[model samples]
Target: MKVLAAMSGGVDSAVAAARAVAAGHDVTGIHLALSRNPKSYRTGARGCCTIEDSNDARRAADVIGIPFYVWDLSDAFHEEVVEDFMAEYAAGRTPNPCLRCNEKIKFAAVLDRGMALGFDAVATGHYAQLRTGDDGMIEMHRALDHAKDQSYVLGVLTQEQLAHSLFPLGDTTKDVVRREAADRGLLVADKPDSHDICFIADGDNAGWLREKLGDRNPNTGGDIVDSATGEVLGHHEGTVGFTIGQRRGLRLGVPAPDGKPRFVLDIEPVSGTVSVGPRAGLQIDRITGIRPRWCGTVPEVLDGPAVTVQLRAHGAEHRAVVAVRPAGASSEGAPMGVASDGSGSGSVEIELLEPAEGIAPGQAAVIYDGSRVVGSATISGTGRSHALAQTLQRVAT
Candidate 1:
């Protein structure tokens, strides 16, 4: 197979590209230039899209004896991932920018260009496995190292993309990968891993937003309302700084029955209201997601099949019954029934057997059957089921 290996100038990508070459595939390396003006020197350890990273990638490609080139996708990255991230935060919703990057730039843009250039697939350092089943469909699964599992970030990939995707670091642990890179004489064997959002240079999220969207704070000095009494508790900087389940940084004076810190239950960017309540209010039983994307095979219908649901990246997974919610169904109301035959307006609902916390709207809910990722969607809204629903009526208000 003619493969295009995406080198991130990291040990993982270098090793993945070398493995692809070792497999006797016609491999070429392409480094994505996401930043228009990449910094000359590394700002601490954030080396994701730096100019140094591209240089490291070129050096690694030289070591692997493969042709290397850098593709500039800064415009697309700024529009799709960075701008959308700011917009989502302004709307008081937490979004996964990493997943968005994988969906739009890497797989969609790069894979399309690679295919047009006669490359069979685009290989990456993602910690995911691709298995060919008897049905001849490539099934994506979790990596062998659970700590470095990146399947969550790549959940938005569809069947077509997975068909042309390769993750050579799947079955190997991170330690082994680094050792192998060292053995192969790769310079990035001891390179530090990049953390946080790449674009946010200083690694401060709210600070970066304030610097970027100056004088246009989402909260606009709005009142923080108490969920129980509907009374104004305090004020906040902006809604962008607060997530759904965040407990600290709220600085609300409201004291719980047990004297615990109040957690942020909801944030209304339209009304500029931040609702604070007890930690129990964060428990979510039902999650409704929009714009669902599948991998390997698109099931004709998802008739309430049991699957595991991961709400946040690197967060805990819970047992859930996955189904399609109706079109006319209210986003504020609990899902009434399932939309059978997989014929719906691209909405998905996951009912957790054990209630999960921190289910914020605009987050991605990646569904899995065992180790294989079935599909994923952006969380539209969440609700409590059974007896807990009545007690949490304050959530609707």
Candidate 2:
């Protein structure tokens, strides 16, 4: 089989490309130059898309005796990943840039180009596995190392993308991958993993938005208020800096009546308000999500037993009961059921284990049935007792 490996010049990608070569497949290596100026971004020994990374990828291709090339994807990446990231933040939602890259740029653009170039499959360094089910549906599963599992981030992949995607490192641990690279004489055997987003070199997301969006709208000052009393606690620099469940970074000097630190409960961008409350106030039992996409497989619409739902990458996997809800009438009404008058949109209800904290609207909540990924959806809203009441009413009706 002919494969085009998306080499990011990282250890995992280099090793993946090498493994593909050793597996008797005809392989070609390509490094995506996502940044406009690759040299301007911090390459260090840890970052990807740096000049050093491109060179490392080229060298690895040489060692593996495969043809290597660099595809400049800066325009598409900036438009799709970077621009969409800023827009999400502007809308008061924390966007996952890596997930956007996987969905729009990597799987959509890069994979399309690979297919156009006559490649059989597009491979990557993602720590997730893909397999075909008895029903001919492609399924994604968690990596062998739970600590390094990245299936949550790749949940945005569509059915067609998974059909031609390859994750060679899925079955192997990081230690084993490094050992294999060393034995194969690859120079990137021990390269440090890229920690932060590749494009944002300094990790200052707010600063990046200010530079891109200008000081017109999203940066407008907002009042950080106490959720319990609706009293203005303090003024925040911007609402974009806060999320649904952040306990730290609130600079409000006012202490609680019991003298406890405050946690951010919600950020209302339109009202220019940031709501704060005690830690106990942060617990939420019910969550609703939108724009759901299964992991290359469509799920049964019937509500069944509880499944493991992942709220964030590297976060705790909690048991949750899920039921598919029908569309509601008004937008303000719960997106779950038919409006009291009977007219509107549908949504999914997630009953969480112990109230999950920091439940943001834009982030994804992926469901996993053991190693097999069930599906995922964009977290739309979270409710405490009220959200649970709505969930019950919607499903019962």
Candidate 3:
């Protein structure tokens, strides 16, 4: 099989490309130039796809004795991942850019181009396992190193995408991969893994958004109100500066009456109102997800003992029961009922057996059956736990 190795100028990806070579697959390496102005994005160890990263990828490809090229997908990346990030935040929702990158850029655009070039698959350094299931369809599972498992981000992949994808480092730990990189003479062996958003150079998300959004930003100095009392606690420059469950840097003029620190409970972008309250207000067990992407066969309902849902990339898994319905069906006042069949274009309703805190809309909810990834959905809305709602109501009274 001919494989296109996506070398990200990192130890993991270099080792992954090397492993693909070691596996005897006819491999070619390509580094995606995601940033139009490479210097605007992070440089050094904190960067993912800068010019330096492209050079590193090229050198790694040379060492591995594979044909290498750099694909400038900057326009596609800006329109898809970067633009989508700002828009989602402007609408008062937090988005996982990494997930979007994997969905729109890596697997979608890259895979399409690779197939056109006659490549059988696109391999990456992601720590997630792919197994051929009993049904003969490919199934994605968590990596052996749970601490480094990235299946949550890759959950957006579809059956077709999974069919043409490869993750060589999924079964191995990060330490082993680094050692393998050193053994293979890859220079990125001791390179620090990139953290935070790649496009944000200084890691100041709020400042970056403020500058980028400019006149279009809805968060131009709004009232920060206390949820319980409806009292204006302070003013904020923008709603974009706040996310659901943020507990710091609020800079409120008035402290909570009870002297307890408050968390951001909600952000209403249109009205530019950020509501702050106790952490308990952030507890939610019901999640409504839109734009569901199934890994393989779409399950009508998932209520098995091993059914679980991960709200965040590295967050704890919650025991959950999920029901699917058609996409345009009215979810308002709808009960969680098992659909006859879950179509690929349908939506999902997840009931967490245990409540999760600070679950914000626009985050991906990746469902898993044991170790197998069932699918993923972009979170559209969330409902507080019944008991928590009641308790809040009592407090209000």
Candidate 4:
């Protein structure tokens, strides 16, 4: 079988490619040049597609005795991932660009191109296991090393993409993977892991946005309003720095009703208004999500059985009842509804066992049935109409 390995100049990817070659598959390495100006990578920060990183990937591919090439997908990355990131933030929602990259670039665009070039599968350094279930359908599970598990970021992948995907380091820890790379003389073995968002290389997101959108940006910041009484508490420069469940840097001199700290309960980008209230205002017993993407065929039941819903990356998985309408009967513009049985298909309404905080639109809600990933959807909106009381818990939404 011909396989294409995505080498990101990281030890994990280098080892994944080596494992693919050892499995007797005809393997080739490709480093995606995601940034046109690779030299502009942040000082003392690690990121993908850097000129230095690409060189390291090429060296690793050479050590593994495989043909290597750099694929320039910078334009696509800018359009799909970078632009989408800015748009989501500008729209008063937090977005995970890594998930979008996997959904659109690595697994979709790169896989399609590789398949057209006769590669049977596209292998990556992602830490997630693909297993054959009892029914013979491919299932994705958390990697053995939970700390390194990347399944959450990959929840956007469809079954078609998973069919030809290979993850070689899912069963091992990061330390061991680096050790293996060291044994094979791969230079990235000692390379630090990439931290924060890759595109925001300096770890200064607000600064980066200021550069892109400028001072007269449309989604510019506005007043921080009170969620309960609609009174303006304070003013903010931008909403990009705020997300749901945020408790710090609010700088709101006014105290809550109980004289406790205030939290960001909601953000309205169109109106340039932010709603602040007690932390309890973040709890939502009900959630409405749209644009559901299944890793496999849509499940047989329109109404879901009990499942675990993962809202944030590495966030706690909460027990919930997820019900989908039949064949997408729910219009995209329709208001939120109760997650009752039957009707729409592509959308889901989730009822959590316990009210969760930090639920935000534009975030991915990945549903898991046991260890296998069932499906995932983007959060369109959240509701605290059911539980508006102030409550704090160890688990975050």
TM-scores, in order shown?
A: 0.90, 0.89, 0.95, 0.90
Clashing pairs in 2: 245-358, 326-346, 327-345, 327-346, 328-344, 328-345, 329-343, 329-344
Residue-level lDDT tens digits of model 2 in 1-397: 8999999888899889988988989999999998898755565876486888899899989988999999999999989987887778778887778878888888889888888989988889989988889989888999998878899998877667788889999998999989988998999988888988787678776666666677655656789888879988889777777777787778887888878788888878777798998766666787887766656434435233447788887788877887755543347653444333222245667878656777788888888887777767778888877765565456535
Top of the candidates by TM-score: 3
Rank the candidate models, highest TM-score first: 3, 1, 4, 2
The prediction achieving the highest lDDT against the true structure is 3
Off by over 4 Å in 4: 41-47, 300-306, 327-345, 385-397
Model 1 TM-score is 0.90
Per-residue C-alpha lDDT of model 4 across residues 46-131, encoded as one tens digit per residue? 63757778888999999999999999999999999988988888887788899899988999889989999999999999999999
**Residue pairs clashing, model 1:** none
Q: Give one digit per residue, the lDDT tens place, for model 3 in 160-196.
A: 8899999999998999998888888888889899899
Order the numbered candidates by lDDT, best leading: 3, 1, 4, 2
What local lDDT score does residue 2 receive in model 3, on the 0 to 100 scale? Answer: 97
* Alpha-carbon deviation at 358 in model 4, angstroms: 0.8
> Cα deviation in Å at residue 94, candidate 3?
0.4
Stretches of model 2 off by over 4 angstroms after superposition: 301-306, 325-346, 386-397
lDDT measured at residue 180 in model 4 versus the true structure, 0 to 100: 94
Using lDDT as the measure, name the better of candidate 1 and candidate 4.
Answer: 1
lDDT comparing candidate 2 with the true structure: 0.79
